[model samples]
Target: MKKTMKTTTPITKTLAAAGLAGILMISASGLPSAHVHAETKAAASTNRVTAPTVAPQLVTSKTLQSKEKWLETNIKIPVFQGLTDTKYQDQLNDIIESHASKDMDKWEKEAAEAAANAQKNGYTMHPYQLTINYELTSDGKDDSLISLKVITEGIGMNNGDPRVDTYNFTNEVEAQRVTLEDLFGKDYKSIVDKAVKTAIAADQDQYFANEDGFQSIDAEQSFYVADGKAYIVFQKYSIAPGSTGTPEFAIKLPGKGSDKKPAAAVVKSGAYYKDKNGKIMVQVSVLRQLQFNVKWNGKSKTTEISKGAVWSAVKLNKDAYTLGKMAPRSLGSAPVMKKGHIYVPLAFLTDVLNLNADHSKHGQITVTAAK
Candidate 1:
């Protein structure tokens, strides 16, 4: 018969041995090599019995490989007409290594530390990139006019998930000849700032209210001093469906100057009204326009009332009481109205009425009544 005994190495025993060895190493500099080897072997044996060692190298390697492949396949570089092939290739390589390297942990850590340091030093990071190209035509005289086509690809990485966005724009630039300075000059910052500001302002104007009621709305307004053009926007409540009343628009113009008011023009277009089935039915040749109307009490009223305006009013479940000229309009579905005032669509006011619309900061609306 063979006898067997279960054996175990406790943490306390191992810790004790390590402590003893450490004390010995510190107290006795002349410890024998044989004794040190014996202690090391014993510690290894105890560690094996107590806890198994885990190696994470394989997992890290696999993850790194997958990320590398993803970057190689997804990353793209635009080849402009003026760029040399070698220079473009070099740039592509640099971008890949800097942005999506396999051994990026160190770089990422360094970048994070640098960013923290910058924040500590009272500096903010505004990361951005843009690419544009265009053609120039001239008869060899004064400054040539440039027809530019711009394509923008931007990434905003905050926290973890990155927001990737793209846009296309076309414009004209004035320059003497085809030079690098012409492409990017002293006015580059101003031009870029103006363009970006315009886009941000437009986006701000397209905002919608999240909460109900008459909260304060703030928006951006633009005016052409020479052309006598002005724009204003406000946020208000939407008219309720099936409600019969007048829809009011409160618009804020650039100035109180009389010349800034829109020209009195009468325009007509087809209008649509919702049927019992809630489907919009088109009403043709319903002339709609905006003009000044005089009330019985001798009050001047600028009314946007037309067949189309009537359709807008009725679809919004409101009554049309004013008449005006027809203009190109993009009307959004009326929101649920609150109180007695019906909020107009920002798009309708901006696109059709040529007013600046902004609901980004606060809710605002401008109402025009006969004065």
Candidate 2:
């Protein structure tokens, strides 16, 4: 995590998209910023639960920059490489494609405009550069998480400090990308809101303006993972002007909410159930608690959630689905709707949300965030 800056600027009103020569800027409003349930710790302890074992890493670094008299572009994009598993390697590449090779086109163009305009004003624009970096937050068989950071500086022409944009990703199931909504369950919005405000309240001196000075977490904030924790990220000048530098708060899953004992099968469903295939299937009601929604118009049904993000269950056969294109999935049995309730495979949800479901010897099933 990058350190927050000290010098502060009071944000009176929303800054305009106004720009200076060769300076491309976005207002602070749009910025970066999820949850999970845990299996019973009592059972997990007996099962010997622990963080996923770290695996060997594959690294690939690319430096692309061009410097001229008036305009300059420097970018450092490093992604994981040397993946032995082609499935995962391809997954990494796809993510980078969306972040850098594709996203940079607009940034680069903005830089050029800033340079050309600055030169016309008899000023040599600050050498504009942006760095795209990837940090390995967590490594695992079920949950491998990565954080991507893109920093742009020198162009803003203010304190000349760089603005930060962080994005987090989990390499899982080959086809599907895990989202925060999937991990923490459906109430992530409120969960994050409480968590962030709580952090800000603890260190009120660190921020400016009112008690609600900081905006609530958005759906698409960039975050990173490290040491089995998820850091909700923010850019410099975003929440507390430049003083806060970049703000990151590790989300604390409340683990409070019904805390209902895992559900049973014969009862026809309310929480989780042991499926006919002997797999635990989480009830949609709990999915609702987790922030996952299942919408039906009486024709087909759709499931949506944020587990790290817009995870949609696609390719429905019977019990099998792609689990939203990020996961390679085959259901133990197709999900079924019984008496207005929907059921999903526990294994599938655990993988998508980056959680671990432990079956204890005492006939208990515990689901917790993957650590």
Top candidate (TM-score):
2
- Window of ten residues with lowest summed lDDT in model 1: 14-23
Per-model TM-score, in order, reads 0.18, 0.49
Q: Write the per-residue lDDT of candidate 2 for residues 1-371, one digit (tens) a residue.
A: 11111222222221111000111111221122211112221110111112233333544445544333333444544444543335655554555444444334555566677878988999867655544433333443323344334444444433445544444433322222334564465555666677677667666666665754776777655554444445566665666665455566765332324242112211123356676679776553344333343333234554434343445563223655554565455756666665444567776656555556666665555554455
Q: Candidate 1: misplaced stretches above 4 Å?
A: 1-88, 102-158, 163-184, 205-371
Q: What local lDDT score does residue 280 receive in model 1, on the 0 to 100 scale?
A: 30
What overall lDDT, based on C-alpha atoms, would model 1 receive against the true structure? 0.22
The TM-score, computed over Cα atoms with residue i paired to residue i, of candidate 1 is 0.18
Count: clashes, candidate 2: 39
lDDT of 1 by residue, 49-73 (tens): 1111212210010011122211112
Model 2 — which ten-residue stretch has the worst lDDT? 16-25
What C-alpha lDDT, on a 0 to 100 scale, does residue 38 get in candidate 1? 14
